[model samples]
Target: MFSTGQLIFALFFILAFTVVLIVTYRKDKTIHKKNYKGFGWVGLGFTVFVIILFLIKHMLNK
Candidate 1:
């Protein structure tokens, strides 16, 4: 039920938000790399832990 003006506003808002996010991330890329080393492994471990938990839950439910 959005009007034409609302749709145009939303489009512009999304584009601007995306552009800002990209610019901000690029600016902080170096700092992020230095500070967040080993972050990927932590994320992987958490993911694996969650999957294992779900498997256990499923097995228990059966």
Candidate 2:
């Protein structure tokens, strides 16, 4: 069982960390958009490949 002070400190730490993370992401949003373009297509392709692999494995096991 944590004390009241420890609980308050934990809450404050989490809130501060979240605020900092949001601010950093907002500051870098433009750079990310410019640099990471087409990454989603790569992710999609990987996901599809994995699904196909699993389906093949399942079919072979039957």
Pick the lDDT winner.
Answer: 1
Model 1: per-residue Cα lDDT at residue 41: 100
Lowest lDDT sum, 10 consecutive residues, model 2, at 31-40
Cα lDDT of model 1 by residue, 1-62, tens digit: 99999999999999999999999999999999999999999999999999999999999999
Please identify model 2 stretches exceeding 4 Å from their true place. Answer: 43-62
State the TM-score for model 1.
0.75
Ten contiguous residues with the weakest lDDT in model 1: 23-32
lDDT of residue 31 for candidate 2: 99
TM-score, structure 2 vs. true: 0.65
After TM-score superposition, the amount by which residue 7's alpha carbon in candidate 1 deviates from its true location, in angstroms, is 0.7
- Cα-based lDDT at residue 15, candidate 2: 100
Number of the top-ranking candidate, with TM-score as the measure? 1
Q: Candidate 1: list runs displaced more than 4 Å.
A: 51-62
Model 1, residue pairs in steric clash: none
Relative to the true structure, how large is the alpha-carbon lDDT of every model?
Answer: 1.00, 0.99
Per-residue alpha-carbon lDDT of candidate 2 for residues 1-62, written as tens digits (9 for 90 to 100): 99999999999999999999999999999999999999999999999999999999999999
